[model samples]
Target: MTPSRVIGYVRLSRESADSTSIVRQRQIIQSTADSRGWDLVDVVEDIDVSASKRRLDRPGLSRVRAMIAGEEVEAVLVWKLDRLARSVVDFGTLLDEGINVVSCTEPLDTTSAMGRAMAEVLQVFAVLEARTIGDRLRSSIAYRVGQGDRWRGGPTPYGYRSVRHESGDGKTLEIDPSEAAYIRQAAEIVLAGGSLYSAMQAIREAGSKPRRAEAWSISSLRVVLTGDSALGRQSRHGVPIRDEAGVLVAPWEPILTVEESERLRAILAPRPLTETRRKASRLLSGLLVCETCGSRLRVNSRRTAGAQVESYGCRANGDGRVCERPASVNADQVETFLVDEFLAVVGALPVVERREVIRDVAGIAEVEEAIRHVTDSMREPGADLGALVAQLGTLTESRDALASRPAEPTIEVVESGETYAERWARSGVDERRAVLESVLTGPVPVKAIGRGYRRMDAERVAAPWAWLDEAAADFVDPYWTD
Candidate 1:
């Protein structure tokens, strides 16, 4: 008789600490198939997948099912029955589907009444064992957290890696030197009053790779800078775990101190959106205004003789309003004139950096809400009282910490030791735009000038400084005339 065609299935759960390896399972299944004179067509596996997962959640299992449904295989062989399905419901579903499942270790003759009964009993025991293991694991994790141990089970925070503890009992997080240096530089950039976007650019230029993504995302960078893990504080689900005395439990080395982390968080906190649309990438985006219709001029570019030439014009605004006598100016000419006039007017002024020391009270209400949730859960049946009590202690500590902070903001201004001109020379476009906003009350209005003016007509521009100078001249002229 021709050997029966069969396909072998194997699975290894992520939490199965003592489960058989995929290689061992494959060896057993292959040996069993050889002994039974079966033609083993293929061996499909789901590694690091839970056996309790539904069929749709397991790609390898789904493939096996599809093959069986197509009648391409006579029997599906496995190293053991539990590796195929951990729950009796799943096992019974497979039986009801008339799947000829053959376990290498636990052979079941499902045609016999006694065989079906034994299979059901074995499946029941498998489910019970899975739940028991899950409970034990949860208890172990909770005990570890309570004892001031950081959980390194999942992905370690950026700039850190899990290493075996000195006692060889479990894993502990240690700073990866290369990645930590990048983090330190990033923190310095942020603390020095630089935007997160600037820090991201610096990291990318230095060839620093993030933990997962090809480059750092704004959200990921914020987490790296402001996360409790950066300050060596243990936390779960973004809430810091506190000890019995309401102090945060930190057991590993830190990339930043508590003060530095707080300051970074303050600087990076979300602010209300403003109507300002001038990006740092553009030099004169929000500065120039059309003299005719008072609409902000937009940058327009054209390819001229194998080169791109940019100009600012107020042809039409977004509201469908077009200037009857639209004004246009060369970008380079206007930029140069503005920079020169700006520096000649206020270049000697000193640059002062203003820093705001803000106390974060945004998450206080959130902590209180979480405390209420945990309290409500305690009244429910089968609630883990020990775990819930521990959680409450941490939440209370967080609330106390937030409540102790002063509500008023403290402002500090220090000299940057650079003149306006000196800073302008070294600053980016966005920085220059900020300087213009500080000195000017509103957009600089440009008079309607025809195209092809090689030099910037100083009379055609009505900058704030020019207006002030002209007013002073008029005041002195009236006195001289009388």
Candidate 2:
């Protein structure tokens, strides 16, 4: 007589499960199929996968479900019902679909009413066992974490090495200073007003190893700086199982301080991953700010004199009522100024400075200018120029207030192996912008005074940090303001 075709399904939740276990399950399933005069049309095996994951995420289980849904097999045979699903509800869903289930280890089968009832009861037991095992595992880990014990298994996070426990029971993670240096540098860069992109450059300049091959990359540094691992916290499957109060469950020391890690998190929380910048044509493309109106100076290009010309311009002052700054500064002209100014200021500093430079240039006036500019537009203009006159008065107040404020403290930079000129020449646009950003207070405000309009003067170019610290303030009265 011909045998009925069936689908053989096997699952060993852990990939580390012994091969003999799989052979035994297959053998038992085959033996039962033969005795029942059934032939397995196809055998599906899920190795190293867990019922803990969703069924769709598991390839073998998904294939088996699809097979069953299509009614391609007369019956589903497994070593045990738990091999199919740890959840009884999931198993019941199969029975509800009018598909027959048979387990080689259990005496349960869907062939008869009594057998079907036994199968469901066995599934219920299987689910209960699975849940009990999960609970016990969670409890064990929580206890281990609460006790401040090291992780017994698994890979340690980057920047840390693991050593066997003193008792030889497990392993503890220890900080690897060489690797830790890179992580600390990343955190400091972000805290110093540098973006993740800047961190990538600094790592490259430091000759630090990247998680990826060759030079450093954003995704690599991102996981380190923006994760709890940097804070000496441990996790698995990207999930935080327990906080375990008062316990520092990390077997290794962290690369960043608790405060530094918190600051990075706060800064990173609101910003989307898409915030990474793409390559731009000019060096200071988005870095330029209008000290006058508090608007970012945009790089606008136009076709003039039969060639493409690019310059930085402000949109708010298009009406020419709010700002006293220049209408537009030449792109090549500004970049030359930045490169020259960068060399003058940063060039004199030591070649290799400290691991981190402090960023203290305040944009208080710039921020206030931004707010005032927006608020001034709230009122409807009168038939006359009253609103305009009122807004102009507000702009003058901002300008005068900013002028009266004391000089901002200079950004102190230590020597890094290379001079600013060398680094600037070697770096890309984003990196150059980062170096410029770390030192400059806000945007390079361009004031058009008969003040050497021909040559971009540094004094008129208002940088928060001096080009070389008080070179006889050369423009107004004895202050020699430009």
Candidate 3:
């Protein structure tokens, strides 16, 4: 009688770290096949793939399934049952296909009823172990985050480079002055109303290169501009991580101030489809609101009697819910009016920079180090537990006191010495928009004017900036002045 044909499957979680794992599994499968008097057709492999997490998309496993479906093999051989699948749902899927799975080290023989029952029990424990390992890893990362340790896992950010920590076990980010200079230049260009491609040109001129690609692209430049790493803040999955004190957790010195970061984000934010396609070329594209339908005013251009007239009209006119009296005004006139109004209001106010003050109080770093020393000493064999306990208590008290202290952040007001009119000449649309947004609480309402009225009406445009109180001066950040 001919021996049954069987295929061997192997998987390794980390291919580079565990070179011997694949070899070991292959040897076990070959030896088992010889002992069982089965014809070993071929061995398939999936390197650096985890069984518990990436179970469905394994190429080698797909080949095994194809062979089983084609009746090319009577049985599938693995070093262990978990190597086939860590989850019951995955293993049950294979069992329901009526394919016999034989494990070299485990008693997972899908042909027998008792063996199938045993396989289910073992799969449950495998899933539990995978989850427990995941939990421990997440807990370890959380502890590190709380301790203000930078994660050295992924690629280092553009403006920063990884360096060995002073204590020497882990890595920390340090501002690379050469690369960081380019970040500053790029931000300045964007803030000054220059395009991202223009910033890319500036970065290239400074002899700075991007991290991954050979040359910098606009998208990559935008990523660097908007990343939390530029603000010296730690983030996971695009969300900033805050400490227990509610302050953003910063491990390294900042490349950009919080105000600069906020302004860059605002400037680089995506415009609406209508604005982008038609190009909001005007300064007040999204800022104007129709008083009738409460919709934003979008720029519209029409050639009336051989002259191309650009105007800002109610967007609701095209959105199926037409405004009863759609507001329309010449684009150039309304922008000029709003700018003049904004400048007349708070444009001369000295922009105050509000920043969180940082101080090293109560020797918190020293206290934490002392606590770590005491905790380590307590773990030593035949150590003095009583003395170590006393030291730890004293260190903990000092640390708590430092943490509990309320942070007194003072507003630093720096006078730019330049009035609004003087800075307005040097500013771009983005800078002007930032200024307008800081003064106005919401969209400015534009009431409809009489048809064919060529004269610009100041009454038609409502100024939210004029209504703002003096206390609103707190919202202003030095833009063109800086």
Best by lDDT: 3
lDDT of 3 by residue, 389-416 (tens): 7766766877899989876666555454
Question: In model 1, which runs have C-alpha deviations exceeding 4 angstroms?
Answer: 1-5, 13-24, 39-41, 54-56, 149-152, 161-178, 188-194, 244-331, 340-430, 436-452, 457-482
lDDT of 2 by residue, 199-237 (tens): 888887888876546877777777778776766667755
Using TM-score, give the best candidate's number: 1
Model 1 agreement with the true structure over 1-482: per-residue lDDT tens digits:
12389899988876366766888999999999999898999999988887765643689988888888898987788888888898888888887876767778885645456767888888898889989998998887776676565453667888888887777667778888889999998898777656798888889899998878998877889889988878676776567775543345668788887667778888898775874654434588878888899988889889999999998888665568967777788888888888898788667877666667676585575467567777887999999899889988988998999999888888766676767777676456766776676666578898886556565766777777533654445321100000
On TM-score, who's better, 1 or 2? 1
Candidate 2 residue 143 C-alpha distance from true site, Å: 1.3
State the lDDT at 199 in candidate 1: 88
Poorest 10 consecutive residues of model 3 by lDDT?
351-360
List ranges where model 2 is wrong by over 4 Å.
1-3, 16-24, 55-72, 152-155, 167-171, 201-220, 234-252, 266-269, 272-301, 305-307, 311-414, 423-482
Please state every model's RMSD to the true fold in angstroms: 9.0, 14.4, 12.8
- Residue pairs with colliding backbones in model 1 are 280-430
TM-score of each prediction: 0.63, 0.59, 0.56
lDDT of 3 at 28: 100
lDDT of 2 at 127: 76
Comparing 1 with 3 on lDDT, the higher-scoring candidate is 3
Instruction: Report residue 109 deviation for candidate 1 (angstroms).
Output: 3.3
